[model samples]
Target: MKREGRGEQSAGPSRTEGLEEAVRQADPDRALCAGFLPASVRADVTALLAFHTELTRALAPARSAAIAGPMAGLIRLQWWRDVLEGVRTPDHALAPAILSALARGVFHRETLLRVLRAREAELNPEPEVSPWRQMMRDGAGGVQRAVGEALGVRDEAVLTRLEASGAAYGAGAMLRHWPHIQQSGRYLFPGETAALRQEGEAFLQSCDADTLPPAGRLAALPAVLAARDLARTSAQAGQPRGLGDRLAVMRAGWKAARMFQKSGEPAL
Candidate 1:
């Protein structure tokens, strides 16, 4: 959901200091998860998000042109690889935190590799939507599995269901952002480019209940809404899921939307 940042900072005490300061200065949605996760796991998640945020910022057009397009995607993939391999000596400020967290969590090496593999596939010049979706589904499944494993959820059925729901949410989110990324020569999903343009900004802006389309406003609905709905439905189905956990996920997402909407930012 985020991108890369500018130049890599030297990995030193000063870099760690700066990174921590940046985390401290992050918005509530970004910083508040520390309370939701265990201390150690929270640090890992924060480090991961921070690293991802930096990556997103770097990929932004206003930053360095050297890492744009395919080259940028390669760099991002390599960064992720380093994190997965437990190599923290890179000059980038984000790598160390991610490495430290991975080390602490005993995160699976294969899961990380799976994510990188999907990313590698994405580096292709022009990718189709179905392939992109499959790749994303795989990568997201890997991450969700790793997270569930870390949380001590042992049942395969539970893990699979959780991963599927998460992937659906992720895919939908990527679909919604296709229009913006297409303008920059990056397609998250193949058909998404056309779909988003067809939907248009006007459709996105007309999300209020009064103006919502009968068929469901794909553009108007935030991607998180899809995830929340999945969670709610799962809960209602009498699955072996925890109500508190489902509510927490749903509430956090809606809260994020409310916060963004209040700030006059696009919630999607």
Candidate 2:
């Protein structure tokens, strides 16, 4: 649900310091869990998460001069699309990892683009729970689908489980991010909020932890965090903000990491 800024570790401490700070603010979930993976796996996951964070932020209502308004959002989305299309070189910080993934034939360009398009469409108001759930599905499922592919899990059933996890995570984020979305001139109806919350809980419950491959479970850390957040909050409530949310994310990451230590069971 979060994407942190990532600086190359090879960079000097000063350069990494800023990235670390930004990452801490954006994707604490990734920063905390990276240590649980092997160094090589950590780098790949970090790059994927970084690009996800960029797209997530870019899709939001622009806050600064760098990317402002709906048109700007489309421009940035197109830039990313171009990166995937290979028409233009990847010029962004996270583009390298994405390009590498592409070169290796692991990236899911269509799903990623759908994720971005879903995000772009979110600028419009979501008045119903069904439409909101659909958006959440594409946004989060896009990443999980890509992660599963990159991990080389080809079972359609397993990928379906990952999709459920992604939808659950996205729905919770929609609830948690409701206030911010409102501040950006978009409104979420109370009925829609309740629907989103309920659907998130349902999707999380539907995900059988026993169904995921070990690598797939690793790709599911965000859903784990979402389930935890849902558990800790009321059905009609938003995820706890600030410190509470941070603590919740860490707790979820810890839970997901523990799953890796188990024997033959990677479901959840």
Candidate 3:
């Protein structure tokens, strides 16, 4: 994570701010909704999101000399894994806060393990489609699940929705990165783009339509962004989002907040 601390002070960034920066970079749409986060578990949720970003970037394909490869990613991941599992405690920006959260059962070793596995797989995944989707599910779903857990949600049905929402988030990532991919002069997508769109939509529709609790909706709001972008992609293939599209993201956040405030259902 070469990103400098933007929300921090002289010594270092606060744990929550560190996480907020990560989300702001990884998916600005999600950052737009950070104001909707309830204060109680904000730190925990942000830390989980930030940690997931770290894993994703660690193993990301090297598009430049600056980009780290699988071996470097594995070392960083091992540090996080050891910290989370209590195997070796180390002083770091996120370790202490994350440890405290884990102590309270905000996230378990199992989910973090799956997250690691999926991220590692991204380094060199099978050509087959099923394994790819499963990697998406494990990586994205694990992050969403952690956010939901921070909200104190334990319903199995609602938990299932988080995973689907996560998969939608995965598709949104591809669409979001399209401009950058082309700029890098190496643009490609796996499988049929239409099928990928449906995969995202199907996972989204699989979620219940009813309103969710504020924190619950906050945890699931990425699904809305995914659905919106997928719709735009299908309607106008290869169109880059403009300022209007950016404003729409902010509007969606406002509307999503209103939905939770009024009736627990998002209008977007």
Q: What stretches of model 3 exceed 4 Å from their correct place?
A: 1-14, 17-19, 60-69, 182-189, 209-215, 234-268
Which run of 10 residues does model 3 get worst, by summed lDDT? Answer: 3-12
> Please, what are the lDDT tens digits per residue for candidate 3 over residues 22-76?
6777755555545565555566666666677777666544434345645665676
The candidate that wins on lDDT is 3
For each candidate in the order shown, give its overall lDDT on alpha carbons: 0.44, 0.62, 0.65
Q: At residue 78, give the lDDT of candidate 1.
A: 73
lDDT of 1 by residue, 146-229 (tens): 544444444565445434433554454444444445556543555633442332222222223223221111111222333343
Query: What ranking of all candidate models by TM-score puts the best one first?
Result: 3, 2, 1
> TM-score of predicted model 2?
0.73
Q: Model 1 Cα displacement at 86 (Å)?
A: 5.2
Question: What local lDDT does model 1 show for residue 252?
Answer: 56
Query: What is the Cα-based TM-score of model 3?
Result: 0.76
Model 2, 1-268: lDDT tens per residue? 1222342222224323345446556766555544454343445555666667887777555544434556776688878888878899767766766665555555566767777777676655466667766676677776676666665657877776777787777666657666666666543433755666788888776666545667667666667567665554444343334565566556655655566556443221
lDDT, candidate 1, at 244: 54
Clashing pairs in 2: 4-27, 209-267, 209-268, 210-267
State model 3's lDDT.
Answer: 0.65
Which has the higher lDDT value, candidate number 2 or candidate number 3? Answer: 3
